[model samples]
Target chain A: MRRKASLILLALAVFFTALSPLLRWYAFPRLAKIPANQYQDMVLEAKNATLLDYGTMQAKTVPKVTIVQTLKGDVDAAKKIDKTAGRDVVVWDGLSYVQGPDGKMVSSIPERYIFDAHTQDPVHATGEMVDGDPVKRDGIEFKWPFLTQKRDYEYFDAQTRTTNPIHYKGTENFRGVKVYYFEQTIPWTKVPFPKTMPVKGITPESVAKTGTTRWYTTVRKFWVEPVTGAPVYGEELHKEELRGGTLLGDRDKVTAFAGDVKMREDYIKHTVALVKSNRTLVLLMVSYLPWGFLTLGLLLLALSLYLEARSRRPGDPASTEVQEPEPVNA
Target chain B: MRALIAATTGLVLAFALVLTITAMGSPMGKTSPKPLLTTVPAHP
Candidate 1:
């Protein structure tokens, strides 16, 4: 009975020791994965430009650029500068604008704006439009409380905390693969839309009267790897699809779409390699380490049993047992 | 009692072996860098 109990306890100890590190480092990291639907505003900054060669179809070009991304959100307050005599600038500011796709009001933000000019320099502006409407400011036009509807803009932090609850949208197809999707707020650098028409250049004060700004929102698709349980990729189409009155229009005027599928794949490859090359698991399964225990336990148990068996020798059986002397001798 | 002592000793040996193997493997673990892509917002 004691031998059996020792063997069982030894087996348990072996199992637990081998399993502890795997559970602590590998299994746990994989389990605590970030969900696809909850990611918002991840900025992908390229360290160096990448070259893409399309054989005979296209020339090799290194597109040096930085990308800013955000999930769709509500346009709380907006200003439209439809008509600026110098440069057609559209400014969207204020705090009251916090409706996101998940139906929560968020105030955190980084200053983001897009104007029709690459440089906010003084330029000749023949025509101007704000929120798709031409503005005619007579004099001193200050629309703060009226523009933002009396709300302040929220600033985002490095930690990227979620201001609202996560609402899981259904799965959808991206590029070619099907994936689960969610909404997040990402940042993007503005691509300047410069309108170049020859005219008398004016100062900010000259045409400042007729400019306005407005806020808008659009939905994006997030793709995740089902097997790995990682946020693999996603894309977003601009809210306003049409540009310059055409179905297929210029890239800047249409919308901004972004994705991160390729990067996620690379990370997965590295993880698989790291796990497979794990030396501990391999040695434990194949080496003489485990067999040593089996041998020792069996040796001790066998010796004990042998000793018990030898105690039952025929000649010694009666001698081994103690007997009381006869009453007659007393 | 001898048998129990033997098993306990073997189990302790097994723990030592596993720990050594794991430590050797730690240096081989690798974390690949994330792929990054940026598209310049098309200018009109």
Candidate 2:
């Protein structure tokens, strides 16, 4: 009975020791993924920004400008892609809308991004595009991968429709959570006019007919929590221009929009809180549970060995039984 | 009988653990409560 108990304990110790690595490496990769139907929205503000008034063909100073970006997952689209791609994927239909202080529309761009749910790597599928143009994305965008490292990453810019290296600058504590800082600079590139214009009858075709070309450049920055790969805080120094067009008259060029865009205070606070909680959840799989199980397994193993040794000792009564003299009358 | 019970208990515990971890990592079911933006009125 004592030996049986030891065997049971020893089996359990081996089981737990084996389970630790399985949970961390196998289960984590298979189970930890972005959901197919996740939806999120963010609001950013730019104060004292420059926006061009197409009506007057002049740059005007606005007290405030707002950008609202939304990303909604398309479940059906993802399911369809999963069949052919042979892996889990997520499709996010995103829109970025800009508005002036008067609550008037400035520009709106719609995008479709498809990527691997676990790795956040762009997946080129049937409907992946940006600003109504077919694009094959080559790098990360909007979000980073799990366990982001302190190295440069190729980041995609929707406006320029180009991928560039975004360098990791350093580490910093953001709202009591450690985060990695990344920065990307996009050079001035001639981009197409927005498919959606603020003014009626002023379409991209109309702008092009007038010989006006749009140009854009930006310096993007993010403070990303490494564990969850989510940006807790982000900002951009964004600028746009319209140049050499009848729309601009004799002026060489006019600033279409120029501002320092930052996440709203409320959104920043909420994001920090969300990332903090997610960090713990991820750590459980990657660190806490694995190590805890390993430690428990080691302790159980020691106990099992001690019990077996004590039961088998030479002087133990259980091991050596006293012989009873048999009385034979003879 | 005792060995059988111990083995069964270990299997059940292992199954329960994997189930809990997978469920915890799964995606939330709630959708967006409200539309993010109002429809833009046609520009005059």
Give the number of the best model, judged by lDDT. 2
Q: Look at candidate 2 and tell me the lDDT of residue B4.
A: 53
Model 2 regions more than 4 Å off: A318-330, B1-44
Q: What is the DockQ of candidate 2?
A: 0.17
Deviation in angstroms for A127 in model 1? 40
DockQ of 1: 0.07
Stretches > 4 Å off in candidate 1: A1-162, A170-179, A183-211, A226-229, A240-330, B1-44
- Docking category of candidate 2: incorrect
| lDDT of model 2 at position A48 | 97
Error of 1 at A165 (Å): 3.8
Cα TM-score per model: 0.29, 0.89
Q: Report lDDT per candidate.
A: 0.32, 0.86
RMSD of each: 20.4, 5.2
Identify the candidate with maximal TM-score: 2
In the range A258-293, model 1's lDDT, one tens digit per residue, is: 222122333334433432343234334433343543
In model 2, the clashing pairs are none
Residue-wise C-alpha lDDT for candidate 2, range A225-266, written one tens digit per residue:
999899999999999999897888888899999999999888
